[model samples]
Target: MLPNPTLDQLQVFLAVAESGSFSAASRALNRAQSVISYTIANLEAQLEVPLFERSGSRQPKLTEAGTAMLEDARRIVSDLEVMRARVKGLKEGLEAEVAVAISVMVPTDVMVDVLSEFRERFPSVSMRLNVGELGEMIDLVASGISTIGIGGAIVKQDDSLSIERIGHSFMMPVAAPHHPLARLNRPLTLADVREEVQLVVTDSSGHTKGRDFNVLSYKTWRVSDIATKHHLIRGGLGWGGLPASLIYEDLQTGRLVALELEAYEQGEYPIYAIRKISNPPGPAAAWMLEAFRASLSRCPNLEAFKAQLPFNRSKDAIAAE
Candidate 1:
C-alpha cells in the first residue's frame, strides 16, 4: 500500500490544480514557487506516478492518473476538514457545526422552519441534512456520523440508542376523491377493506410495519418514494397509510379522506427525536431538537395531541400501549 500523503502536499496539489500554474499556486498559498513544485514532486515520488505532463511553454496539465489522484486528494482534504471540525467543535463549545439526519416522513416545511430558526440563533453553526429511511437515520446516530436524528418508532429489539417521543404522527388510510371510501358516509368496517387494493412503502428488503389489512386479502402495491405514493393515491390507484402532515392540505380540500376503521389506532407510530446516550449532542444539535418540538407545538392541526406531551415520555407509557 502507498504511504498516506501529507495534508501539505495535498494543499499544494489542490492549489496547482485550481490555478494551473505553480507560480500562481505559490502566490495564492503564500509559499515559494520552488516549495510548491517540490511538494508536488514529493507527492509524485511517494505515489510512484507522474501526476503532471510538462510542456515547453503551456501550463502543466494532469495525466489520466493525475485526474484520478486529484479526486482522491480532494477526499483526503475533506476527511481532514471533518477531523478539524470535530476537534474545533470540542474546543469551541458547539460552534464548530454538526450534521443531523431526519427521515422524509416529517414535513419538509417544518424542517425548513426549524433549520431557519437554528441558523438565526447560531449564525456560526453549520449543519448538513440527510434524508433517508428510518433505519438509516438510526444508523447515523449510532455510528456518530450524525449528532441527532428524527425518525419513526423503531420496532426492532436493539438497545444501543435512546429515543425521545417528541411528537405523535398517525397514518391515515387515504384515497383519491373518486375512490369508493370517499363516498362512504359511515365509518368503513375492516371487512369492507378486505377486497380493496393497497399501496405500501416497504423497506429496502420489501417489508412494511403495522398490522395486516386482512380484510383487503393482504394485497399490496409497493412503491419506494413517499411522494409517489401520495400521487398514486391521489390518482385513485390504491389506498395507503400516509403521515398526517403530508395529507393535511389534501384532507382539508376534500381531495383525500381518512378511512374509518374498527381499530383506527393500529397504524400510529410515535415520532422520535433520537440521540445516542453515549454521545450527548452539542448545543447546536440540542437547539435544533428544541426547535423541532416548538414547530410541532405550533402546528395547530397537530397541536391538540402533541402540545401537551414532553419530548421524553416515560418508557412505561410507551410500552403500556
Candidate 2:
C-alpha cells in the first residue's frame, strides 16, 4: 500500500511555504526545527516528490511540484480547521446549518455585508439563503423552511410566529428617463400615472393577495421578483415604486427619475425579522438577525431617507415588536 501524508505533514509544509524558512516556520509553529524538517522529509518520501530544494547557504526554495501543491495543501488545512470548529460548535449547541430567507427588496450590498460578517463570525456554520419578494420571506420562516426571515412587515399576523421590526426601507415612485411621466414637464398627477402602465411587484406566497398598498395607476403589470420589476421599469415599459436603497445609483445617474407626484408620494416600509415562535432561533440564527439589522442601519441610501424623517418617529417605528 502507498504511504499517506498526514495533516501534520501538510501543516508543516504550509508553515514553511508561508514563513520562507524551516527555522522561521518552527518559531511560528512553536515546534523544533528538526521536527519540521523531518516531517517535510517524510512527506516528500511518501509522495515521491521533492517539496523544497536546499542549498548550503540559502533559504529553502520550493520545487516546481511544491509550488503546484501549495494551494491544495492550504485548502486541505483550512478545511480541516473548519471541520474542527464546526464539530466544536455542534458540541456547544450551535446549529450546524441555518436557513435564512431575505426579501428581494433588501439592499443587495447590505445583504452581502451582513452575510460576509456572518461567515467570518461563524465560519463553521453552514448558511442556506433564499431571497424572495415580500411575504414569501415570512412564509418560509413560518413553515420551518428557514431558521429566520428578514423582509417587509407581515400584515397577516400568524400566532405561531414572532416578528421584530429591524429597520425601514423607503420605496420611491420612479420611472425610466424616457418614460412619459419623466417628460411630463409638470408635476405628475394621479390621473397622469393612471394612464401609464404601473409595474408592481407581487408576492408568490399570496400574502398580499386581493390587496393594494400603493396602487396609483389603474393599468398595472405585476411580477413576483424585484429585479425583474426594476429591469422592466428601467426599460421604460412602466413605472413603479422601488426600494430607495436599491436604486440610489440609478436615480443619481439619471437612469431612473423619481416622480414628483401630486398626492401619492414615496412611502416608508418597515422591515422585519421573523422566526417561528415554536422553533426559536439558535445562537447563530440570532446573531444573523442582529447582523442584518446592523448592516441595514449603516446603509447610506436608507440613512439618507431616514435623515429626512423625524428621528424619534423613525426610532419609534423601528421599535415595533
**lDDT, residue 90, model 1:** 67
Model 2 lDDT tens row, 186-302: 578888988899988877788888888688898999887889999999999999988887887787666777776756655557788898888988889999898888877765554
* Cα-lDDT of candidate 2: 0.83
- Please report, in order, the local distance difference test score of every candidate based on alpha carbons: 0.72, 0.83
TM-score of 1: 0.59
The weakest ten consecutive residues by lDDT in model 2 span 310-319
Model 1: lDDT of residue 211 = 38
For candidate 1, list the clashing residue pairs, or say none.
194-215, 194-216
**RMSD to the hidden true structure, all candidates:** 12.0, 7.5
For candidate 1, give the lDDT.
0.72
